[model samples]
Target: MADIKHFDPDAALETTLRLFWRQGPEATGIQDVVSATGLSRSSLYATFGGKHDLYLAALQRYVEQRSEPTFQRLAEDERGLLAIADFFSELVTARCTGPFARWGCMVANAHAATQNLTAQNADTQVRAILDRHHQQLCQALTQALTTARSLGQLAPGTTPRSTAEVLALLAYGINLRSRNGADAHALNQTMQTALNALTPSRR
Candidate 1:
């Protein structure tokens, strides 16, 4: 007789996502997934394949739910430098105070664990996530800075592509720092100081 499966895989994945988000795959083991998902080891293996597969799914979910919408909004926004500033400001606020507080970004966190991940699939997925994040930031900054330049918001000799690269690195830095429990105020101040260099001489 075929045994009926009683667990919700979607619900299980959500639980898995939270666990992986908090501790990351390097520290989180198969037993931790079983514990967090309330599933038997066999059930997890049968349903999700393995921890790496489960993490890949969870990472895709994170990008779809957490990153894509925000990037889209920021990219389309006409607020230029204010949009960029607001992006970092919101990141600090959410990272420090929200329900997902201290979770950092799964994509950014993945970079640190790349040296330890053995699976090619895991490496590919992590690289894809990072690349998508970089391209999105570049797109948003390009849109915003095009406007900033038109409005004289950028200083003379400002280069949009190079500046966006710097800001993207800043975004990744904030994600890692917030995961370590950095103060939101200090993070925001750090972000503002970075942005100040791009400001017009008047500000």
Candidate 2:
């Protein structure tokens, strides 16, 4: 008999994540996982508990693997404002060209699916995490505004706080539109408009 490879739990979870990425959680079934991952039912159940549990694990994996990097990089980079723009640009590029473009953001999709479970909690744990992520972005924008001001990149009297707020709004708006299937060109144009608005020459 041929030797069989052991099931990889991480690999299984990633496969599930991609499926959920391509199709929302409610739309994805256990059979879809089985078909995509080629894992036996018993094995999946034994490894990840069940569908809901598996979905959460997959989302956590995505946060750790994908989302965190962008946040961390922007926070640490010098051209942090430009980094934020690039991040949004990357989002547009990913959704425009990646395999899962049409499915929308997993986190946003979860908002519709998991809102009730989180309704009574003292803090919406999911929203808290997302808020923290956005907060880092706002901080990065503040840093960028500072850098821009130092370089005389802004018009006189353009405060860092005001510029930061504008950038943050632009970032959030990009995310909201992207989740609604906005195109890359539309996002790029929006970003450029925001940039032009914040620059001295355009103001």
Best lDDT among the predictions, by candidate number: 1
- Candidate that scores best on TM-score: 1
Error of 2 at 169 (Å): 4.8
Across 1-203, the per-residue lDDT of candidate 2 in tens digits comes to 96444987888899999898767777889999999999988888888878777876787777778777776676566663465567668867776666766555665555556554544441265565556655666676677677767766667778887777777666556655777778879889988777766667742
Error of 2 at 197 (Å): 1.8
RMSD values for the candidates in order, in angstroms, are: 2.0, 4.2
TM-score against native, each model: 0.91, 0.76
**Alpha carbon lDDT of each predicted model:** 0.87, 0.71
Q: Show the lowest summed lDDT stretch of 10 residues, model 1.
A: 137-146
